[model samples]
Target chain A: MELAKMEALIVDDHPGMRTAMRLTLSNLGVTHSQFAQSANEAIRRIKGQHYDIIVCDYNLGPEQDGQQLLELLRHNNLIDLSMIFIMVTAERAYEKVVSAAELGPDDYLIKPFTAEVFRVRLERVLQKKSAMAPLFPVLQAGDAAKASELCNVLAASHPAYMIDFLRIKAELLMGMGQAEAAQQVFEGIVSERAVPWAKLGLARTLRLQQKDVEAESILEGVISESPEYLAAFDTLASVKDKLGKAGEAQEVLSKAVAISPNTLARQRMMGDVAMRNGDITAAEAAYTTIVEKGRTSFFRDPNDYVNLSRALLECGKNEDAINRLREGRQSFSNAPEAVFAASVMESQAYSQMGKAAAAKEALGRAMALKDSVPMTDELKLDLATACYRSGDEAMGARLMDQVVRNRHEDARLLQRVRKIYTDLGRELEGEQLVQSSTQAVVNLNNQGVLLAKQGNLAGAVELLTEAAAQLPNNQQIVLNAAHAVLTLVNREGWNQDLMLKAKRYLEEVRGSNATHPKLVQLQTLFNDVQNKYGSRV
Target chain B: MSGQDEALLPAMLAASLHEVKNMLGELTLSLDALQQQCPQQAAQIEEMRFVTRQVSDRMVQVLLLYKNDAGVLRPNIEAIPPADLLEEMLMEARSLAGDRLVVSLEGEQAPPYAYFDRYLCEMALMNAIHNALRFAHSRIVIGVGRLGNALCFSVEDDGPGYVPAVLQRAIEPGGHSRDGGTGLGLYFADRVARLHCNNAGECGRVQLDNAGVLGGARFQLILP
Candidate 1:
């Protein structure tokens, strides 16, 4: 495409900088250009029109920075990946460099540059974009294999982009689930030069292959060598979490948050890991930061307020915890889970403060909404604890029994459930209950499996489906039911009822235990069934 | 200063420098537009613009060195095609010189890409090019190619080479013999060069030599 004919958008909050960029863009022979003073305005323009090039300033003032804007644009699929996006900024510090590099813009230009410098950078980006223009359609169509093949051909033909092409090729390989090939490509790049991004790519490939130790070592080297590489920290945190070192994972996330606290996802991760490790203070701080920073992010969740109040209560700050719960209701009253979790937390707080009457009243309110509220296992645990402390032993035992039956194999969650009963002076009873509940679920799963093997797929699915409803917290039972339903569907040839049941089972455990061994296989099966039979239904 | 205070000083300086750089950018735009209308006085306007650029370049150098000294400048090493880097350097040199001098990129045409921090390398080359523009006799040339195992970027001019006394203390930043020179330009170049370490753990180095393509002083930044 001709340089002058392509449209451009210049985004900078400072008018002087915008005017300067306009002159620079005009000098490069770009006649059609637009300016936006903030990321919001830029997004509106971007959504309304398709500009060939966008020059965005890194600091877009308060609404959203360039990085967040780019993330939102990419995340929402509002902009095609092929557009030429150049990040311009005055800060050349490693902080900004790391943040911008993580986003992988076409080019980045530091400010205080001459018009000549601007033109040279923009032209280089345009050259790279135009060279890869043919592959954009395949990539946008989500044809990973086709995109990888086309990228290889284009890289061989256009040797000038061989290095960048290799990087893209590795990424495409990863997207296509060819982690071994991606690792090979990344290894080749790292052997040539220990580029941090390439090293990180290799680490991610190793991670995809479940080589957590190898990925963790490489990630450790990356962050130590380049302290400002925030993504490495995040990767290392997850790797540690996978390795079952929740404390280390929390530490890694804390380090990352120390460097860049505005990332709400990292803050949330930090809170989760800290809570899992039982570091109430750390979890409280992380959740507080999340609540504060989440105001500007689209990722804001009402759960943060609930988690923050729970953490405060755990830290024995009853007054502060009560205040947080009150604030959560005021802010997120529309979310039913938030309101229910708030009542549970309030009951627990009041019980801990020796206000028996108030605690009993709050627990009643929580129990009254039990049928209306969609319950997660964590919420069940909270309500059970509240009920036990508020002198509702029978109700607490029922809820705790449900938790034990559903997650019998989850030792940590089982331990937490046992603790609720033990704290209520029923340790022996809780142990017996846990043992019996676990045995019952195991027997049900075994029988279901036997039925499937004996060609009684329908009977197996029926048994497991009923078991899943009774033991809703049992992921193993749910997955077992899903598998039996798929087996039954395979035999019966597209049963809409079985497909819906299988989908419901899979949906229950979607984000929870996504790392389960059979989760991916089950999801793939469910998707295949939907694709093959969804239309007829 | 305490470590925390030392770390904050560079950020403050960079922030203030950002404001100054924006103003300079605006001034350059106005000067560039005015130079077009009044070609008769283009030389004087170009000279003023050169000074503005130099001031901005100095601020960048200072901020970079501060970050480097505080151990905060982690080089984002990457495989950079030399042709693109030199092309960019030549463009900036052309704008700074306007019609006063000729600027061109010379040497290797293909990509046996050099691994370095592209931004810092570009800034270092711009500094070298700016220095060459001040001393060159109507012509400046930038050379990019492999020198043995190192990737070398050199700016050469037709003007007289560096004096013997200045050459003696060439590598010592802030130790130059000249009173007028800030001595920061070469210092930044050397710092950036030294940051690029090879697999063998050998850092890069900078060199000063005369009688290059232009037969004047050649400021070479060689990275391993």
Candidate 2:
């Protein structure tokens, strides 16, 4: 890749910037190049022929941006790996930059650059692309194995791109749950660089091996080095809570929330921790903030209001609690979860206020709708607690068993289940029930994995599918079934009976992990094979 | 081209109507390089280049006003070091003066950081300097200083004084006090000053007043 031979495309809405960039390219002896003013025009040009370079202004026209255009193009596979993309932005935004980097652009250039600065950027990108040219054709043709091998070679030869290539390679490795191999690369990178992403990768690998303590340390290292990395703080805090270091976890979350006060999940986690610590004031604040701020965000949760009402009821604010629950329902008019949770709160409020008839009405409504409950582990826990408090101890114990079974690998959730049982006056049985349910879930998951590996794919799929019904929202159970069925279908032919079972299992897995690479990849191959062949026996 | 479209364009293209008083800048730099090679013709060529750059500056000011009226103007705001910025402006004024105007950087060099889009600030300064050069009799003095709270940067000429109507227009409710609001040099200057005020941050103000060793119009920009 001689500089002069490389074809470059410059896209900008402003004629001045476009002219400036053209002059820059000409200065580097690239006399021939293409130009486009809008995203649509750029896409049209790209479709006609591949260019070695693209210099796109971050703001195209008023309608779309460079990153959005890139996403749309890559999503459709209209552009190949060898076409180097450079996004030119004024750097006015923070989120857009991160998203572009994560989605993978060749590089970025801040606006108003001099000729020298522009040349420095172009040369850097061209050098890297040329170095990785050996693998480009295979990657372009969708050969993942050749792409991986090429990436390995580039990682060894090009020390500059080693970090980036290794991280991408490790993501593919971990997707297949080759945890030991992924950890080796992650550990190698972290040993020299102390990079936040690599450290987090190592933590994720350790999490697979159930090493919470070491994973917690890696997360903490990320926090110390880069306090603004929100994901690290979140993972570290969750690991702390899961390790029963509730107070420590709360402190970590408090710092994280101070920096970025916007996620519904984090606020809900805070509320739950506050409730555990008997900090009703803090719990109300956390829940109220989430309810108020999460109105426009995708992370909005109805649990915030339900928890708030519960906290108010515990404090003897019956009127306030009643209004709180009503407000929650009014805000989320059509959500069944909100409707059900609010009804539960209304029942508790009325029962406490000595309004027996209203209490009975609310309780009956909850019971009627409980049969059609969405069956999330969270909802199950809430219902089980409600039943136990209302004196149906047997049913409550059974429901609690289900929550415990779903979260068998989660020691801290088991503790909460134990506490909930003790609160309802089944002290002796609560301990026994939590242990029994946890063991059952672990046993079933292990047995299913063993069966799948032994080529008893039919039996493994059956076993995991039945378990998914019991623990519908559990990641491990749903994924086990999806993976088992996908493996069976991918290795052997897709039997019609097995394809239906696999589709059901995959539907559950997709909801929780759309980008979990293995599941996403398997789902694609499985669906294609299922549609094309009918080799049912 | 269509008959109607052809009818719209000027038949004999002349210089832009805004003002040929500025942009001696682009010419001077180009001519200065040429003069080094041809010293025998350098003196007269240098003079022509200086005058040409001055014309270009005025042209840009008027062109900016034209575009402002057409509503096609886009301003870019970026942070610049006020001290280095002031120093550079002084150097440009000094070069244009060629011993006639003595511009000195005063007080602290611009602080390490000040926020205003660089090109916009440069245009505003260029206008005030060109305006001062035209009005100054023999010597023009451009001063950089801080007044109380904000960075009060001024361009002053040791000329007789500002024309009365122009002075009044600087303070008047609108910038359209000239014969035809089209010359718009003062108007665009005022607007650029205003546009650079707080672009998404603090509110800054641009103003014209009389306060100088030379009893002339002073252009002041206060950025928060």
Candidate 3:
């Protein structure tokens, strides 16, 4: 933790800032320092070498700001908790910039700060980092229980970081699916002081426990008190969405976007919620911003273009949708999924424009490419829509049934399915299909759970594993299989084949949604079993 | 200007000021390097750095005032150790004062952690420290203490006390002394202080007194 021993990277577009930062770092005895003129160069340097610290300017020549860079680093797992990252901003309204980020830097320094101030902030962060060093290994190993235990010890020893330790403990509990315990910790913090973060944490915990009413009230209070807190807005929108108020969620997201408009995830969420609310104009605007701003950034996704096209088609701008799909097809020329999505959307646009021949041609192209790439539920829904529009009811029904079977628990997708069916005047048939598919999955899951309860772990594992194989994208069934496998291993002896099966099941769920609540618990259980049996698998 | 252009005027000005402030920050570091390389002219370099910091601080004040006008200047209050804040101000003051003045902490120990905005309070206290460094005959004392239910940070200097006119203006609402400088620092300090309020709805304020612990001027920023 010595300043002289720390290797640092300074990221700034201005040569003057680089020179100034270098001089300042040297003044603080930080001799081993590197400089990068932009975020891309900084990322490149970070990939090549390890740096103990990174001091990056908030404005990095318009390509990517420091916050976006931090997000990229975090999302890609390029940076870990061991290193320190500090953001430097000249704007006094820096809260907007920092709060908009999903993963903020370790600390931020306001611009025009002297070397003395910089040293103080750096030293403070270093102290906190060292205090947290003991828990990192366990945390990285996915041992949430052990990490929570260490948090208590660290809070006692490092009283200055007690709240920080408690916050981590709360998040760990949430990750382990112990919503009640997380709620207690958050409540303890909020009772002493209604800190905005603590309130937000409590609201999230409440939502996890299905207490949406309480969560909604707390989030409303948080947003009113701290209007610039963008995270609160996001959480509030989610809670509202869970309460079936997509229109209200869109309004809340609009306010947050007005305050700070550059967050890609927020923009995407805006596009989604607006689309759900049938505000096609707002959806088009949000998707347009995403497609424009994300063109050259890591946040760019081919789905953004598809989404934009969908909005345009909804707005009766078929030619514009077709033009956008053509451009998107070229931009993502080598990605099969992108090509497939563009083709499907193109067919939809053509069908909407009353060009049956063109639509039929596009549909043929899409069907040929469909099997070449994995289909997301959204893309499958689009293909189904295209099929129905092109007078292929049987093909559309088959696709819809597959989607419903795989994502039976997804209310939003189910709603979209219903809309598609209603638009085609097949509401009764669609309802029956949805009910039968959902009931089938529910019966299978229930039977497995029942077998496990009857002390027939082998029977439970066999049933759930087969169900999971049949519906690979079904997170609930996959998680149940993994849980049964781990529970059997824990109760009986560890079986190598069963352990690998459990690992694969967990990995499948993680590949689709890493932050799934059941994932961390199952992963921790798997790790514990592995450690106990002393097996590499 | 068009209506749209007029609406963007504050943001444009704020951006320009931020750019200027960054340049001033660079100039300050250059002065620090120059002082190190040419120790004989360290005092002169330090003085130039002092002026550069003053401009930078003024830019921040203007930007903050604009935010206040736009009703967005909310303080991000946090629990910060009082000693750390005082120590930071002491270091900056000593660097600016160099060998000309004795800048020191007033108390043996700092108070417990207090809830306030560290950056805003630092800006206010540093402005007072800079004022003290300008007029102090020999020394400046920075300290933190409790005032009733509020936390108080004071900058006391062994300099000529504030003039009666300035002291009177300090007590007046929206008052600025037209004595020597633009009085923006005091106005900004007052605005920053008022932005901090406790759950009990008690707002913070600035108090100026001629009777100082250093037998001169004493400026106190009291926050609830």
Q: Of the true interface contacts, what fraction does each candidate have?
A: 0.33, 0.00, 0.15
Give all TM-scores, in the order shown: 0.83, 0.50, 0.87
Better of 1 and 2 by TM-score: 1
lDDT of 1 by residue, A1-537 (tens): 887888999999999888978887888888789999887788789889999888899898876788777777776777776788888877665245553246666777766566666777777877778889888988877666678888789888877687888888898776544667889999998887887888899998887777889999999999988887888999899999989988889888888888778777788889988988988888989999888776656556767777888788877899998887887777775467667878999999998899999998988888888889788787888898898887777887788778888789898788777776776688998898888878888888999999989988879988999998888768899999889988778667888777777777766775465346566577666656656665322
- Which ten contiguous residues of candidate 3 chain A have the minimum total lDDT? A93-102
Interface RMSD of 3: 2.5
TM-score of chain A of each: 0.80, 0.63, 0.89
TM-score attained by model 3? 0.87
Best of the candidates, DockQ:
1
- Model 1 chain A: worst 10 consecutive residues (lDDT sum): A92-101
- Interface CA RMSD of each prediction in angstroms: 2.5, 14.9, 2.5
Sorted into a CAPRI-style docking class, model 1 comes out as: acceptable
Name the Cα RMSD for model 1.
Answer: 5.0
Model 2 regions more than 4 Å off: A1-150, A153-162, A310-320, A371-373, A388-398, A408-410, A426-465, A473-537, B1-224
Q: After superposition, how far is residue A182 of candidate 3 from its true place, in Å?
A: 2.4
lDDT of 1: 0.80
lDDT measured at residue B39 in model 2 versus the true structure, 0 to 100: 89
The global C-alpha lDDT for each of the candidates, from Candidate 1 onward, is 0.80, 0.67, 0.85
lDDT tens digits, residues A1-537, model 3?
Answer: 688898999999999889989898999899999999877788889999989999999888777778878888887888987899999987665666665444668888876676777888888788789999999898789777889989999988876677878999998887655777889999988765577888899998887667889999999999888888888999999889878999999999999999878878899999999998999999999999999888777547889999999999988999999989988888887488888899899999998889999998999889999888877888899999899989998999999999999999888889899988897788998899899989989999999999999999989999998998889999999999999999999889979899989878877886765446677677778878878887746
Ranking, lDDT, top scorer first: 3, 1, 2
